[model samples]
Target: MSEPVVAVERLPHALDLPLPAYATAGAAGMDLLAAVSDGRPVTLRPGERTLVPTGIRLAIPDGFEGQVRPRSGLALRHGVTLLNAPGTIDSDYRGEVGVVLVNLGAAPFVVHRGMRIAQLVVAPVSRVRLVERPILPDETRRAEGGFGSTGTGVRSGTDNGGFPASEDREC
Candidate 1:
């Protein structure tokens, strides 16, 4: 097969980590297990938790991190959500990559082969600086009121807080 476009480094394992067919193009944010191995993805009844393995560890370059995100199809259909969603694996981390997933659905949900459980995106990060603060000026009328304090008023107010939480038009 052809090589991938992104710059990535593979780690040496005690045994070779054979790439799953579905994960060839990329890790595709998920891994398939030959059998149900402990901590290698399991189904959960209501209020159950399981871990899904990626069978790989990366030597990420400096100034970058690998973010593990939930698969949209899995979340929408099964109501399965990553317990610690969008978990980050730092450049310095050398451990195996895995996702902590939970079934939020009322019934048992299975995590089967080729199920896109999570995503891995390598991105650059910024180091923030800290400063002691003096009182800042009011940026807007809704300066302090937070967490749904601003009602959803389309024709009446500046923000409607539209359904499904529209990301655009941040106040």
Candidate 2:
């Protein structure tokens, strides 16, 4: 499939920082940088959350949306992660893209200028038209069952019609 063209606007403060880009040919996301205007680092205490600015805006296509995700390296090494992983950035939005990062580690993490804080993944979006109906248009064997309706581990019963049965109830 062909890639969509995303128009990115770099603000004055972010002129020195590199624009978001894919690290590899097969990468799905573009690294978003932290545009610290005054060149001062932002420190996040343990268990604290903050919105880090990117100083850039995007003009996403009408049928697409930008998904902000956390960096796996940061999460595994420093416990820093985006509060709302896969945060949605609608196409209509024209403001600077900011990431809500939280520190889940025992020590504080410092966010510096041009640091790769998060990633932006542009994806296609589908708009559904909802119609009121008394019943769904489909049916399934596990209708209305949720949570741990499936067995915790290996099971030994036929009450579920070959499907895993809940702890005390048959499928």
Candidate 1: C-alpha RMSD after superposition: 9.1
Candidate 1, residue 142: CA error in Å? 3.7
Query: Which candidate should be chosen as best, given lDDT against the real structure?
Result: 2
Query: lDDT of all predictions, in order shown?
Result: 0.62, 0.88
| lDDT (10s digit) by residue, model 2, range 77-98 | 9999999998999999999999
lDDT of 2: 0.88
Q: What's the C-alpha lDDT at position 29 in model 1?
A: 53
lDDT by residue (69-97, candidate 1, tens digit) is 77777788888877987889888898777
Q: After superposition, how far is residue 127 of candidate 2 from its true place, in Å?
A: 0.5
- TM-score against native, each model: 0.64, 0.83
**Each model's RMSD to truth, in Å?**
9.1, 7.3
- Go through the candidates in order and give the clash count of each: 0, 0
